[model samples]
Target: MFKAYFTDGGNPSDLVQLARIAESVGLDRQRAEAILASDEFTREVRQEEQLWLSRGVSSVPTVVFNGQYAVTGGQPVEAFVGAIRQIMSEAKGGTVS
Candidate 1:
């Protein structure tokens, strides 16, 4: 589970454990394990890392509003509500300060 990484302190020890976790979340274990062990997965992971790096996402829990306004890191419920309201307001041709 993602909670294993974020909420708890459980980190994957190896590709096997990673695949196990994926399986636990309903992914095909054998297929996921095979993919994880391949160079394709490594390249895909690296590409995702680079993509996030270019997007100024250096950490987890980053939330974006219409791909324009971003609330990074851990935030409160009110913060999310505020971002959503602002985006909605902008979409309705209303300005948000």
Candidate 2:
């Protein structure tokens, strides 16, 4: 999906394109189309969206560590490493510089 969206220039908002993308990844095309056509999982998806929204997640690729610390948006590997170290240090009752 990421490849189709970013590399192939596929429009994710288009159901037909989405179904095609799903089929490309070995998913049943008809079932994918059927699910997209219906309101299936709509409520559950909305609920999850609301949960993230409530958690102050307003961007893509938001990483929440231990449900406490959050790193949002695209970041370098060092940023994630630092976050993990900080979270681990805090868990061990220590501090990371």
Candidate 3:
């Protein structure tokens, strides 16, 4: 869907384009088209968006670790490594300090 919308300049809301994108991703095109045409996943995606909004997420590529530490936006590799180290330390019963 993202590839279709951003890269291919196709409408993400269009089921045909969505099916094509899904197929490109090695997914079942027919099943993907059916799901896109149906209202089944709409509520799920909306719920996830609402949850992100409630969590103060207003941007894409937000990374949440263990549902505790959240780092939004694209960051330097060092920043990601630091976050991972911190999360790992915490998981090992040690403080990030």
lDDT of each: 0.80, 0.92, 0.83
In model 2, where do residues sit more than 4 Å from their true spots? 95-97
- Order of all candidates by TM-score, from best down to worst? 2, 3, 1
Ranking by lDDT: 2, 3, 1
Lowest lDDT sum, 10 consecutive residues, model 1, at 5-14
Tens-place lDDT digits, model 1, residues 40-92:
67777888788778889877779867655788989999999888888888888
Clashes of 2: 0
| Off by more than 4 A, model 3 | 1-7, 95-97
lDDT of 3 by residue, 1-97 (tens): 6656778788766778778878988999999888877898888999988987898888888889887688889999888889998888878888665
lDDT by residue for model 2 (1-97), tens:
7988789887889999999988988999999999999999999999999988998999999999897689999999999999999898888898866
Q: What is the TM-score (0 to 1) of candidate 3?
A: 0.76
User: RMSD to native for every prediction?
Assistant: 2.7, 1.9, 2.4
The residue pairs in collision within model 3 are none
Say which candidate scores most in TM-score.
2
